[model samples]
Target: MPHRIAAIQKLTATEPHPERVAMFAIAGDSASGKTTLTKGLVEAIGTHRISSFCTDDYHRYDRKERKNLPFTPLNPECNYLEIMEQHLQLLILGQPILKPKYHHADGTLGRPELFIPSEIVIVEGLFPLWSKLSRATFDVTAYLDPPETVRRAWKIARDTTKRGYTTEQVLSDLEQREPESEKYIRPQRAHADLVISFAPVEGRSSLSATILLRPTVPQPDLHDILTPATRDAAHIKLIRDQDGKPVDALHIHGHAPEAASRLVEEKLWEKIGLGGDIPASLGRISSTERSAPLAIAQLIILHHMIHC
Candidate 1:
């Protein structure tokens, strides 16, 4: 994240604010591995550095409660959005926030968690970046664009295995989640600083993460920035627009042209301005690294958590 040029004017408040706490967000479609990514970011930086929550926790009604209704979690009307916004504001101001816990398996709200002051906050979920107020809370924001086929497959497996849904039950839930997705989830990509999507080509176990790094921030170089996690999975390339502007895209797997991959990596690493051997710790767990979709999510969240 670039240094904040915008300044906050002093305003009346009951509690004194802490050093302006930076907030970052991850937004994506259902079953698109948002949780997986968020989990990793929390892991990379100890949870203490980041107090995180999923927007799914703010659903206005539990799944069972909403089953009778025509809409599901995808619709903004179905979430306690104003409350979520208030919570973010509190967290940003170095204040305490008592947050509700959602029991996804049972579709119920659990006890409230005592969230004390934190310096960095990571919020993840569908439409996490949708609303202007919510978007304003983040110093860095991401939009995940995994293919629907991959997302659906991941969702089906996850719901059946973890949430105890039968195959058919999972399918039905997916169907119910779709209408809201089309209406609300897919339209918020334009506001993000980065848009990441994975495209897996045939015969390759690997996949490429198509990253659109918007030119709105001071772009970091990927070279010195290249940890083992990124270097091993894919090569980077730069894609130039007709007007001679360049957009960086990573070729993680499948069908990314060699020329493009070469283009992106050079520019990305160049931005980082680092020299000497790369960090050996980064790819240490390469063999055990999570799925590309999940890894991509982690990388995105990690970017915001640290940069923001």
Candidate 2:
């Protein structure tokens, strides 16, 4: 796939202080591991350098109200989108806002409270990059694009276990969410500076990842140097997936070797010029670029701060 260059590379300031509370957005569809990846990034960056958050806290209505909506999860109409954008702007400007809480397990909204500011705040959830008003607040934005099959399976498992949904119920909800996903969620892809995906090979648990940099950046072909052993262990393989289309027909899943993903990550750090191995709390992946979705987010904010 051919790469796209960002039309506007202007970096917007997120905080008054360059050293603290820069804003980032990780946008993706349901079950794309946005939360898991964000958590890993927070751990990798260390709690001291980065603070963590989920835009899931910004829901206007609790799960019950959401379930009753005509359009389900992807429905922009159902969420307090305007409110979310408003509060995000408030928080990004280094001001405090009354944050709401939603408890998925109970399908309820918890009490609201004021959250003090932090150095780096990660906003991860569906539609984190939904509107121009909200998208502008982000210095870096990444879109997650794991294969549909893997996403569906992950959704089924997650909803069933964590959210008290049966497989049948999950399917029904997914179907309802599909239309809005195409209309609202998918288009957000164009707004992202980077797009990354993780999928399994034909017969394995090895998760392959692909990262696409907006042509505006100086990122190189990161797939070349991935070693054979790395691919074998992580089960990651990279096929050119430029412009949302596959370049070659390669089997994904456990079929991919771990080296494929590692090679890309190795190239990631070498390019970023940011050093130091990944911290232990961030899972077994030791490379910084493997955490591209989040790290790129930081770069976005940093660029704006330096330039602003």
Candidate closest to the true structure, highest lDDT: 1
Model 1 segments beyond 4 Å from truth?
A: 1-17, 223-246, 254-304
Q: How large an RMSD does model 2 have? A: 9.1
Tens-digit lDDT string for candidate 2 (14-110): 3245344677778899888777777766765666656656666666777777766666657776677787888888877677778787777877878
lDDT of 1 at 140: 86
Q: Per-residue lDDT tens digits of candidate 1, residues 207-275?
A: 556677767664444654344444544556788633466777655654434444343343333333334
TM per candidate comes to: 0.77, 0.72
How close to the true structure is residue 206 of candidate 2, measured as C-alpha lDDT?
Answer: 51
Candidate 1, after superposition: displacement of residue 60 in Å? 1.1
lDDT of 2: 0.63
| Clash count of each predicted structure | 17, 20
lDDT score at residue 290, model 2, on the 0-100 scale: 42
Question: Which regions of candidate 2 are displaced past 4 Å?
Answer: 1-20, 216-276, 283-308
